[model samples]
Target: SIPDELQLQILELCDMTTLAAICRTNKEWYAKASPIIWSDIDFVELSGDGAYDDGLIDQQRQFFATCSTRMDERPDFWAALAARVQSLKLTRMPGIAISYKSKAELNDSNDYIFIEIWPRDRRNIYDVIAEFKNLHTLYLFVKDWWEFSSIGESEKAVAHNLEKLTNLKVGGQINQDMMLALLSRPENIQHLSLINLIHSPGQDNGPNPVLFLRSIQKRFTNLKTLHMSKLAELTEDTNITGARWEFDPAAEIDLLEEWADFLRHVSATL
Candidate 1:
């Protein structure tokens, strides 16, 4: 029989399915393969048609629930497992619309139909994030604007504690304050991608893309790649009949100078 160290090295080379199979075989293999399997937790929604998996959705829900339960029951074991997680991909399940109904409207049986299914628990997503001590790469696909803001509001300190975080990819509606709060503390962020970032023009002039670029330029010295797309602004116009707000594309000429400056600043790292 091979040495345990050699077995672990061999297990590391196996694919997820193969490792999972190995875990089911015996207790020793389970102990060896489990940590490697949990190292990268991917619940990211796959692109294109028929990519959504119902089983995966159920698993994600169960994961959150289990974390809440296990942390209370076996705090030491859960802490160790959480620490093993290095990469995490969090996204909403396709086709399952998140209902934002009040808690009174949701019964226990139908709570799963809504995104607020875990409200009863004290631990929100940010709490779960704080547990992953070794997290380096995080991919978060935020479906709602409030959810994006909530991250900044709830766990302002958690982002700062994520010293190992370097690669971050976020999508959905992001405002100026929320964006700044999210990016302010993650000093080691090297690769950043923001997709479908909706900029709402408020009293503070909304999401100033150029300003954000400048902030990024100042904050991250190790920054290499910065990718942003669908940078549109939402403006409220009382003049428009029946519609209060209108979507407008951000002016390219306005950001050209700042973009150039940012490019020059990060050119060495890039």
Candidate 2:
């Protein structure tokens, strides 16, 4: 028989399908392969119009349900598997379409259902995340603004406790409080990316650009790579001129100065 260490090394090179096959072969191999299979969980490629396939919806729902629990009541095998996860990626999907309801009625129904179910689902998801004490990387992409806001609200506490995190990428709308929570372990983070960010309408809802830059400059001393796209403060016009929003010349000058100062501070480290 091959040595256990060598077998594990072999399993590490295997893909998910191979790992699954190995797990079904015998108990010893299952023990060795399952952790590797579950270590880097990804749901980012789950994309569709939400009506293309009912099976897809069912599969997604099953995954969420399974992750909702940290397997406290389940067997130790599952708990052990959950603990092995080091990276995770999730993306929000479109709602199911129902033909029985009118457009307005369907939207109203879905809104009510989503409002009720999402919080519970989010809580469960975070509960599992909390179980991942060894988690190092996380990526989340949410297309819906409301869902993004809801996720931000739920992410504060769980994300604050992720001491081992080093890389994080988020694509959605983020508020000031959420940003603060995400940056709680800034000392450990080396890579940060914020993409496709949507601007909140009010000043209170969105992060202040000056303050954000200052935080990046001061807190994230270990940051090596920073990428942000579609950021609101950098692109939004502060002034409304007759029926259109126009960029204020004064604000542009001030923003440029702030960026210059921030860059100067982080130039040595970045």
Candidate 3:
């Protein structure tokens, strides 16, 4: 048998798949390999049959069910699972409506994934973020801007624990008020990546996205790295939301300038 230290070193060198396989062999292996595997949670888009069910993402429902079960039945393990997660990212959204079965309780759902898409089943990820207590990084990879607004509950829960977060990445259309709220929450955000942001221009009668872009300096004063993108003029309907709006080139330039000024500030701080 390999010594535990050497086993750990070997596991660290292996890729996630290999370590995950090793973790399943036994508790000894799990104790050795699970930590490294859980260190950085990266989720890519999953497809195939279970990607959609009856025009809904049924898989997400199962994930919520599982979390509910764990929270209720396996509190100790659930807590341990939460504490182990340091980095979290969900890279793709199922291109359909999220079907909520309020009639069915979270712990009582019967649609066990039988298995497609690794843990797209884990989309019920709110409590993991809210109660985790030690998350260092979070990435919400929303394909559509609208989806960001839908996860308000998760966002609010995360807000309570933002003091410990050091890195964050969010892509999608987020509400301007919440954007301001979250950006200010992190006390020492080291890296920030913002992608495909959207704003409701007509509602305010003034440019939107730029409003949040300009506020970054005040909200994230201690940021060390920042990336902002996707403000080109929208000439056609969006594939994700099927909504189109006027994109202001001039506003884009101003946001870019704000980002630059913040970068300069970051450089000065260094």
Best by TM-score: 1
TM-score (C-alpha, index-matched) for candidate 3? 0.67
The residue-by-residue lDDT of candidate 2 on 1-270, one tens digit each, is 898889888888876556779999999888788778789765554433423343433344455556554364465766676678898765552321112223253354433222123333334344456567678888854333242334554456566567788888876545545555666777788888876443232233333222355665576678788776544444443442221112245544554675677667656677
The better-scoring model by TM-score among 1 and 3 is 1
Taking the tens digit of each residue's C-alpha lDDT, what string does model 1 give over 114-177?
Answer: 3453343345555566678788888765433222323443356554556688888876544555
Worst 10 residues of 1 by lDDT: 93-102
Candidate 3: give its CA RMSD in angstroms. Answer: 7.3
Which residue pairs does candidate 1 place in steric collision?
Answer: none
The lDDT values for all models are 0.60, 0.56, 0.56
Model 3: residues with Cα > 4 Å off, grouped in runs: 44-65, 94-127, 145-153, 199-210, 213-216, 219-221, 232-242, 249-267
User: Sort by TM-score, best first: what order?
Assistant: 1, 3, 2
RMSD of 1: 6.3
Residue pairs with clashing backbones, model 2: none
lDDT of 3: 0.56
Candidate 3 lDDT over 1-270, as tens digits, reads: 878778777877876557768989999788888888777654432323324342223444444455567777899988887677786655444321232442243343334322222323333445455665677777764333222325455557767765577787876545565565456564478788887665543222233563564556655556777677765455555442445554456766666777777666566443
Select the stronger candidate by lDDT from 1 and 3: 1
